[model samples]
Target chain A: MNGVNIGVLAVQGDVAENVLATQMALEDLGIIGTVNEVKTPEQISDIDGLIIPGGESTVIGTLSMVNGALKKIKEKIANGMPVFGICAGMILLSKKAKDRVVGEMDQPLLDFLDVKIERNAFGRQQDSFESEISLEKIGISKFPGVFIRAPSIIESGKNVEVLSKFNEKIVAVKQGNIVGTSFHPELTGDLSLHKYFVNLVKTKH
Target chain B: MIPLAGDLNDAKGIIKENIGSFGTKRGTSTLKRGFAHMLKNGVVMDVTTVEQAQIAEDAGSVAVMVLDKLPSDVRKAGGVARTASIRIIQEIMDSVTIPVMAKCRIGHVYEAMVLQETNVDMIDESEVLTPADETRHVWKWDFTTPFVNGARNLGEALRRIEEGAAMIRTKGEPGTGNVAEAVIHIKNVNNELRRIKSIYDDGDHQDLISIARDLKVSYTLVEQTASLGRLPVVNFAAGGISTPADAAYLMKLGCDGIFVGSGIFKSDDAKERAQAIVLATTFWEDPNKVKEAQKMIDERQSMLGLDTKNLELRMQERGSTA
Candidate 1:
């Protein structure tokens, strides 16, 4: 049995927590997968799946460009690699991102997911929040959603599958093999989302 | 999914009301502590203007410390350095999405209160600013906002933590752009922790009491520090860190993160240097990666460093002087 190999984009953000969650998810599924932090483009190419954890999207985008991993990941995604992005990660995957209060933002983004994003769609730091979100599409009924300086999906392409919503704004979506969540699922100690991503990777392999 | 209000004003109010009921787990301290924890392994840049804050944010700083002037400038000006103007602070807050932090003169609780009310994410009871109260420091436990204080050694770190500092940084002389003082201070704390850990291993309860007295903190906290082999809260490297190498060196020494002041924007290449420092700090364990980051900056464009010995105002000594 060949094990799945997963990579977490370690340019920045909550890398460690996601790594642990993925490991736990793999264990729960009784599947073999080696998790590693992908800093170089080579690492990104070698991974069976990749996750971009929540952090500062502006920094992550720039660093990914500097390290040359951005171009490589885009190629891998173009080839249909399964990628999961959380929070700022979700913002990066969007084709267009606008600030809810400020109108527009100019940060470097992967622009992979065909969706319009609203940065800080809820509120700023102190206004961060948590709520139960139904992601039944991924087989989870009520998953806790942790939103910190979170962004929500305002619009998506026809091919995109809407996964979850909070207060009526779209917060999670899946476009083909790309999955992005406005809220952090790993932070909530839920393994189903990560497991689902792993299963996506397995089926693709 | 509940549909949100169309109006931005209504959306904000609705989210606020929903979050208000849960009130977060534990209390104020826990919430603040959790925020500080998120800052671990990240760089917090000192910024003086809205432009600088934006640059810092664009450069990937986890947070920006709002200041009226850089510490080196504060020292050179020689007048009273107080909390940053509310107008500038608000402007910086509006400019950047990253956490905005500001420093208050030591023991100036009122200044802290103002910063907290302004909705800045964190406050620093910093000696970088002139001490407002010569005899005491602010009781941070009184504020809802988390406070980060400076320490030259383990005792000072423990004392400030006991005073309710949710975060701690080494009190190296600020504004020098010299990492020497910070290196020494961080080593002092690390070495002191190792010694205390040995004592703890030996079951020396009597020595713990005397150590607590010397640190001026509670015995239980001291014992906890010994048992954990580090400060109870996060400890960051601060004061006089200039180059990406300097940031990486401190990370290698086991500090959680870093705080860069005049070393950045004061230098010729603010954007490049800021980004390089963040990368180096993140990949400190890898010399090859650190070398790649080092190549990103020009040595000639780096900040002109001041000698720690030649400094007239020593911010690190403020803890004892008070």
Candidate 2:
């Protein structure tokens, strides 16, 4: 597989980690591809797939929306460009997001995935932790789920695929070309989820 | 998750430390460093009040650090500076939806414990406050709270990391509103990192050990820093930053992020300057965008910078060598 350009939204947050993980995933699968940090609409339009790394969703969503990158991402994902959102990214991709403590924060979102997300579902930064999880459908038996002030998918549409759960909470899900994980796979050394996304990007491209 | 109320002693290693580090590990290095990674490319602002915290959040700060006074004001009021009151911290935490951090005097364990008790997202073993212990910083690994510390060079940075700082920042001249010291500190760190990386690249294991001894840190940390060609944790520019260009310049120098201590509120136009600095920090690579950010504020609105050469309180030099 070649010429599959993957962009990690770089308005703010963990852009480098995702880029590094995508590069490693490509190397593992022996796929020739490029992973670029794209923030502007023009840069984002060139990518076949996108990965929104974990961060402060309010900051990322607000900044991305101000620069018009969020609108472009919404268009691309709607037209079948594969996208993977982690943590704050997952919150941005959902149809609706509310803060667990404050409830109903006013922030921008992609509105691509039909899910109701809870920002800081596990609680605050002090509550951030890691856990053993399995993405069974993606052929990974066990993975480290690094949750740092992470969000949770409280509800999902009928079409969404539940990929993993922790303590009976929805942590990972996939709907068509869009995938989201409340836990950060890039933070850990696991390349399974990233590789799976790469395979999807390669196939689609 | 068990709750420890009014019991500070049991809070140590509480919350089921074994949060899975691959397998059966407690609060693994990955979890600590991962916290820093999530904050990359973002601006964390210093706030003294609930109003300022709201301003910072509105300006897109990744986190707001609660302080007793602005660093500039702290320098002006030369008494023993300590952590902000728990009431104010909690108020700010309640007010903002973003992560809230607080500063404790360097090596002040009780202060850190109290801040952790308040449930601040992170504790700063900061030198901006008075150093509580002369020769020892707080042993951070004993507590579950992640920490960020200031460092003037690579040796200090590595030592803080060894002492369990999840994030590192330049110990620039606080309250001065000058980026010169921060520039010097980051350049020193980058130079040292380059030295070790070249040594590692040349396969000179013997030289790294000698350098580690000179730096007064461990060989393993030196090797790791060298191998990565960067710090094990996120390194943000801190202490003295005022202008949008100052932030963008540091970002161009390879800082993962920035902490504007007295930059925003110390100036005449707090709201506009805060937004401009955030914009400059996020789009640091693009000069045209930075130019637009710079034009957002007037020159008269900038904080009056102090001469670093004449300052009696060289905050960067305190609580370091340990």
Q: What proportion of the real contacts between chains A and B does each prediction keep?
A: 0.07, 0.48
* TM-score (chain B) of candidate 2: 0.93
What DockQ do the predictions score, one after another?
0.27, 0.48
Model 2, B1-322: lDDT tens per residue? 1111112233344356443333333344565667777888889999999999989999999999999999999999999999998999999988888999999999999999899889888898999999999599987877777889999999999888877788899999998999999999999999999989999999999999999899888787788789888887889999789999999999999999999999898998999999999999988998999999999999898988998998999999998778
Model 2 residue A162 CA deviation in Å: 1.7
lDDT of 1 by residue, B1-322 (tens): 1111111221111222344333232113434444565566789999999989888888788899999999889888998899999999998877787788999989897898898789787899998888888678887766656789999998788777766777889978899999999999999999999999999999999998899888777788878778877777778999999999999999999888899999998999999999899989877877988998899999999988887896778877885544
Instruction: For residue A43, give model 1's deviation from the true position in Å.
Output: 1.8
State the weakest 10-residue window (summed lDDT) of model 1 chain A.
A123-132
TM-scores across all candidates? 0.84, 0.95
Model 2 lDDT per residue over A77-124, tens place: 889999999998888889998888777878888887889998888777
Best by DockQ: 2
Candidate 1: residue pairs that collide: A167-B2, A168-B2, A168-B3
Q: Largest TM-score belongs to which candidate?
A: 2
Looking at candidate 1 chain B, the ten consecutive residues that score lowest on lDDT are B1-10
